[model samples]
Target: MSYISRLGSAFSKSSMFASEFFLDLYMYAHYCGISPFQDRRNKTYYKLIIETHAIEKGLSLANPRMLFGRKKITEIMKAARRYGIGSNDLPILMATGALQDYLALHRSAGLSDPLLDSIDAFLKDRATASAVLGSGGLRHYPDGMPSPSPEKAALLTSRFSCRMFSPEPLDAETVKEIVRIAQTAPSQCNRQATKIHFYSNRERIGQLLALQAGSAGFAETVTGLVVVAFDLAAWGGAQQRNQGYVDASLFAMNLMLAAHAMGAASCPLNLAVPHSTERQIKIVGEIPKDQRLVMMIALGRPADGPLKSAASPRRTIDEILTIRDQAVAAA
Candidate 1:
C-alpha cells in the first residue's frame, strides 16, 4: 500500500480506540462503582445470602449438638428480615423459612441452647415469618450426617465460605501451594497478568479489611488475606480493559478451590468500595495504581470442630439455561 494510505488507516484505528476508551469511562462512572440504585434487586439478594451464611458459619463447627451464639444468630436473622422486607424477594423468603426450620428442628431435638426463646419470639410474627418461610424451608439431619457423595461433587458442593478461622497462624508454604495451583487459570491471550498479595500479618489484614467495609466478626481472625489484582499493562486497548477483572476473578476462584482442597478455608471479600476506599486499599495493600483490584480472599485454617456452612440453595440448571438452537434455523 502507499505511505499516505497506511498513515490514514493507522489514524482511523487510533481514533476508533479513543472513542471507545471514553465510552467505557462513561459506563464505568454510571454502572461500576458506589452506585446506590444499580442492580438493587441483586444487591439485596446477596445481602440475604450474607445474613443467612452467618448462621452456617457458626453451626458448621465441630460437634456440640447444642445451640450457641444466641445474640449473634438473632442479629443475623434481624438483618435478613430487614433486607427481605425491603426487597420482598421470593428467594430470601425461601431462605428465611429454611433457617427457621433449621433452628426449630434443633430446638425440638433437645439441643440445649438459650436461643430457642429468641427464635420463638422471632417466629411470633407468624405473618412475616411464614410469608418468607414457605412450605418447604429446609431439610434436617439427625446427629450424624455423612458428607455429600461422589468425592469431587462433594468437594464442589460442600465447600463453604468460612467466616471464622482458627487463631493459629496459617502456614505460608500452604498458601504458596494453593497459589501455584491457581496459577493454572487461563487468561485472555495467555497474558496471565494476575498478581496476588498475601497478607499474613494480623494488623495489616485488619487495616485492609477496615477499608473493605465488611468482614466485621471475622476479619480480625483471618490468618491471611489474598489481594487479587490484575495488571492493566497486560492489555493493549480499551476493548480489553474489563478483561483484567474477568481474568483475575477466574484466578481468584481457582485459588479458593485450591485452598479448600488443601484443607484451608476461604471467604471471598468483595472490593467494590468507593474510589476513596480504593485509594486507601491501594496504600494498605501496596498495590500499584496500574493494577486493578479484583477481590480479596480471606484464607486460613477453619476453627476446629463440626463446621456448619450455609446451605445456600442452588437454582436448577433449567432455571438458568436458555436453549436457542431453533432460532438459528429461523434466522
Candidate 2:
C-alpha cells in the first residue's frame, strides 16, 4: 500500500472513532440513570423492573424471606397498576403466591407476624393476583437430575441458572479446576487475555453483590463470586477493539458449564454498568483498571433436598436462527 493511501485510511479510521465517541457521549448523557433528559416512561419501566426482580429473587433464594417480599409487594402492586398489568405481571403474582404459602405454613405452626396479616389483606382484593394466580403461577417440582441417559443432548438441556445455593463454601482448588477447564475457550491470536477474580470471603462477596443490586437476596447464600475480565492491552488495534469482550464472554460460558458439571450451581450476573459504577466496582474488588469486566458468576452447590427455580422459557430455534443465502442471492 502507498504511504498516502495508508495515511488516508488512518484518517478515515480516526474520523470514525470521533463519530462513535460523540454517539457514546450522547447515550451516556440521555439514557443512563443520572441523565436528567431520561424519559419518564423509561424511569417507570425500570422501577417496575426493580420491583419484579426483588419479588423473583425473594422466591428463588434458598431461604425464603417472607419479610423481604413483604417490603416490596406493595410497591410491586402499585407499579403494576401504574404500568397497566399484563402477562409480565405473572412472575410478581407467582412470587406473591409463594409468599402466601410461607405465611400459611407459618400460621399452621402457630406462628404469625403482623405484616403477614396486612399482606394477606392486600392480596385478598388484588386484581392482578386474582387474574393470574390460579390459572398460571410458579410451580415447585421435585429436585433431581433427569433419569440416567448417556445422551449428550440431555445433559446440555439439564443445565439451569441456579439462584439458590447451599451454605457450604467452595474450595479454592475446586474453583481452580473449573478455571482449568474454562482455559480451553478459544481466544484471539492465542492472547489468552481472560482473567477471573475469585472472592470467597462472605463479607467481600456481600460488598460486591451490594454494588450490583440485582443479586440482593441471594448474595448471602453464594459460596463464591468470580469476576470475569480480559486485558485490553493484549489487543492490537481498531479491529480488536471488541475482541476482549467477546473472548471474556466465551470464557465465562465455559466456566459456568464447567462449574455445573462439577456439581456447582452458577448464575451469571450482569456487569454492564455505567463508567462510574464500573470504577467503583474496581476499587472495591481491587481489580486492575486495564482489565475490562465481562460479567460476574455466583458459584456454589444447589440447596439440598427439594428446591424451586425459575422456569424461564426459551425461544424456539426457528425464531433465533436465520438462513441468509436466499437474501444474498436476491441482492
lDDT of 2 by residue, 1-331 (tens): 9999999999998887777767768988888865778876567656655555555555556666546666576675566556554444444444445445555645776767777776566556554435655211123547642232468665456666678788987888899999999898999787899989999989989888888776876777888999998887898655557789999999999898788677777899999788888888899899999988889999987777766665443334675689766555554
Quality of model 1 by C-alpha lDDT: 0.71
lDDT of 1 at 149: 56
Quote the lDDT for 231 in model 1: 86
Q: Poorest 10 consecutive residues of model 2 by lDDT?
A: 132-141
For residues 1-331, write the lDDT of model 1, one tens digit per residue.
Answer: 9999999988988988999988976787776534674686565556555556555544443342356555556765675566653333545554455457657658667775557766666555545544434322433333222234566667676566776578886798898999999998998889899999999988999899988865765677888998999888898765776888999999999898788778888889999888788878999888999888889999998776544444556655776787966465554
lDDT of each: 0.71, 0.71
Off by over 4 Å in 2: 1-13, 24-50, 69-72, 78-141, 144-149, 236-240, 315-331
Q: Model 1 — TM-score against the truth?
A: 0.69
| lDDT for residue 34 in candidate 2, whole number 0-100 | 55
Off by over 4 Å in 1: 1-90, 98-150, 326-331
